[model samples]
Target: MAHRMTPPSRLLASVGLAAALAFGATACGDTSSDGPNGAADITIVTGFYPAQFLADSLLGDSGTNVDVVNLTPPGAEPHHLELTPDDVIRLAEADLVITLDGFQHAVDEAIEEARPAAVIDLAPAADLTTKAGSDGLDYHFWLDTTRYGRVASTLAERLTELIPAEADAIAANLATLLTTLDAVDTAYRDGLAACEQELIVTGHTAFGYLAQRYGLVERGIAGLEPEDEPSANALADLATLVNDNGVTTIFFETLTSPDIAKTLAAETGANTNVLDPIEGVSNDSRGGDYVAIMNSNLEALRAGLRCG
Candidate 1:
């Protein structure tokens, strides 16, 4: 899928906002309204789309009386996301704040400042691997369906603690979500087992966990940060690896620039396709939600790897 890069000026603005938020310049405001049926008003503030999706699923529709808000806007990159003043206030007054800590500096600072009633950091909930050449934890564990299911189960348990009266409902929703996730896991394991090739060349290291889960090798041109530019030598090395591995496609993500992938593909005579990290939704996303997009990713991998 074609995606326009976040403009330089917009990125700069986001950085500026992050700086301002770090200094506590943003003013706090009121929290969300009370919950339905006289339950405690549960305001869930998430750092990005995946957490938000999980919260929404667990909480059910608006009738569930939980307010779910994702700090990262739709179609925006979750990394380096800037928290608006309104977001700061919401975080301050939220009942539960869920995030993949270390993924975004702005969100980390906001959570520290806000100090909500309860916080669930998905990074610790799920087993995390370190990015290559970096000591920091990889915060994109949600890409692996099984690991994501673990996180969801943990989140449901936490939500039950927050709202004891709704524990049964929360548990039921979690079971449904887990069943779907298991299906995805089965599909991935079965589909990738007999692939023609196990080497995946991606634009970034976001898929490390996914690759690890399914016993595939991932050669990421860039590190954890999608916007990081590749060195000339690194690009040349990636091109050589792609050609040596007989990689049919170079995978790019939905939110990052595909220029590097295109460049390497052009040099290696390979094609380019999207392997969504599902960090956030986009206007041109292959699927509307996590399950749909994941299925699409499965099909892409089957085709790209020549699975039998």
Candidate 2:
């Protein structure tokens, strides 16, 4: 089990919107709705793409009236996000915020001080049981579509409680979202049912939850955090595992460098392919949205792992 961390719901008074207006967070809403200029003027700040995706889905059409802000920009690593003064002010002024406290240190600090109107920490809903890199909790729960679906239900229930007027719409959207997730789960289950290799080597340990759910083993060149560089001995051991286990493909991430993975693949005489963490979407990402990207990943896994 990962070291249990608490996500606070400290709902404090707003710190006035003037600070955010003054600072002008240029890189706001990378995966969000319109700015805080909607009809309801309700601001919802999501820490990154995973939570942002759920908010976008559950809000249904009411997203037009709600201002959804995502703090992390496209193509950036969510684990090491740095917030500016305006970002903190945005946190303070937001009507509701969805964040996983332990994942991003800077955002966690900002949330403590900014104290938005309502903060829903996703750790409780995510059920992060998988441990990685020295027994730390793997925060990439959304990669497993089933776990992501469960989190969606939790978010929908809480959102309906907060905004009762949109309850009906949220319910309708929840049905649709759940159906999609169910289908994705089925696809992954079937697609990876019979593969030549069950081990997935990657740039980092972000896929622990996903791998655990799908009954595949995961090895990373780096540790849990993307920046955790591996020792030379570790790399040599992973290369030997690749050769011994017949693991043909070395998976790299979209946000991080491919050098380490590629070098290992060359040493082991294996191939390299992309295995996106779906942390932040970008033009270079495999697909535009969650479902599409997941399907893209399935195809890559089947090809690389020699799935039957």
Report how far residue 196 has shifted in candidate 2, in Å.
0.8
Regions more than 4 Å wrong, model 2: 1-40
Estimate every model's Cα lDDT from 0 to 1: 0.80, 0.82
| Candidate 1 residue lDDT tens string, 12-93 | 4455434544444323222233343443456788888999889888878433567788888788888879887667656765
Error of 2 at 225 (Å): 1.1
Candidate 2 residue lDDT tens string, 76-153: 988989886667766776778899979998878777776667998888888887574467888888998888988999
Candidate 1: global Cα-lDDT?
A: 0.80
Highest lDDT: which candidate?
2
True-structure lDDT of candidate 2: 0.82
Best by TM-score: 2
Clashing pairs in 1: none
